[model samples]
Target: MSTQVPPIHSTAAAPMLELRGVHTHIGAYHILHGVDLTVPRGQLTMLLGRNGAGKTTTLRTIMGLWQASQGRVLLGGEDITRLPTPAIARQSVAYVPENMGIFADLSVKENLLLAARQARHAGQMDEERLQWIFGLFPAVQKFWNHPAGKLSGGQKQMVAVARAIVEPRDLLIIDEPSKGLAPAIIHKMIAAFEQLKAAGVTILLVEQNLAFAKRLGDSVAVMDNGRVVHAGRMADLAADTDLQQSLLGLAL
Candidate 1:
């Protein structure tokens, strides 16, 4: 059976992740400009924006891949703005980039084994949890010994996600899980996220697909010009076409 964490019921609960006036610069180019964002505990928050809007930069800053030049990144109410990527990961935050980082040379099983820090081998990994993940993405178990590089795009995305959850994670950050996926595969991806939400894992996603976002998002933040321009309930955003057009330039 899945282990259930207490669900977050109110805005009063401490946010699982918070970015306060965060600014980031890469060399001479200033990317993020005083972004203020709050990801409520135990909810899935969608980060939406157009190209060059700095959505990826926000996620990268949260992961510490890019250092925030100003303000702070807080996790469970603690400052982590300056922490290195590995140190930040040790705090139980898992990030999957747009590329879906995985060791292509390794078998699917080996890829998951690496993510499970407590497990030196497949046998040492949590069998119950592995079985649960297998149920979520059957391709993981079906091609256990196949090289990750050999799998199709959709299968590889499943493995990438499965690896992130191989060990329990307090926060899961993903960039565009449905990008380039077929409609059928997108539906399966949606189902997997639904299950994750029910399990109370706090998730932050950057997606261009408004339909997918509307279906899975509990809260929504829209970024423009390196700042969060809009924030509100997903249901509210879904209901207001004029607001959607004004913020996102399109209706959901």
Candidate 2:
């Protein structure tokens, strides 16, 4: 009913985040069958799967939003499986879900300021960190006074990304960024991710868009029926037509 993933990410070097023998269950459904994944420090790793393949659930389990029924989730050498979502986030993990969290009624600056406030020791929106997000999206600077609900879809996405990174998290988990956007807008999102990667942020992304995934992923894991069947360097996945056709149903 499920396939075992090959040992792809070597342990010669310790990873920034490692999920070993992870098993998760929801109600009567069991997901993440013994999932093993390693996200190396400072590299972008992606999780790919068709709908219902447990990609989004896997991200949720890692975030401890949905506690794993079984497994060890380690982040930068700390065991985080039992930690709460807020604790995990404070430990330097950020998430940008498919529904990019934007306060529709809030101004662009207000939304960003709220996100940055998470890292603030005792305040909301650290001024220095707020400036960094503003710098990253000059458009944000242009729309500081504008309501988020009025911004374009791409601009909303920009707000989402800016919010995730404002606190300078050690790991960023982004889910399905290309779901309903125009190709041009997806490219813009990709470019922003590239900039984040260049800034030395570690990212673990769950993506359905093959073209977009290949472009930013240093490594990839393909999930099928709640199991990881393929894991390897992004370049290997990109060049292997047979693997793609047989396992992923999509070829580069």
Q: How many residue pairs clash in each candidate?
A: 0, 1
Candidate 2's TM-score = 0.87
Q: Model 1: per-residue lDDT, tens digit, 67-160?
A: 9998888888778888999999999989999999989999999999999999998999999999999999999999999999999999999999
Q: In model 2, what are the clashing residue pairs, if there are any? A: 117-125
Evaluated against the true structure, the overall lDDT of model 2 is 0.82
lDDT of 2 by residue, 55-77 (tens): 88888998888889887888876
Q: Model 2, poorest ten-residue lDDT window? A: 5-14
Q: What is the alpha-carbon RMSD of candidate 1 to the true structure?
A: 6.9
Clashing pairs in 1: none
In angstroms, how far off is 225's CA in candidate 2?
1.2
Off by over 4 Å in 2: 1-13, 118-136
Residue 76 C-alpha lDDT in model 2: 78
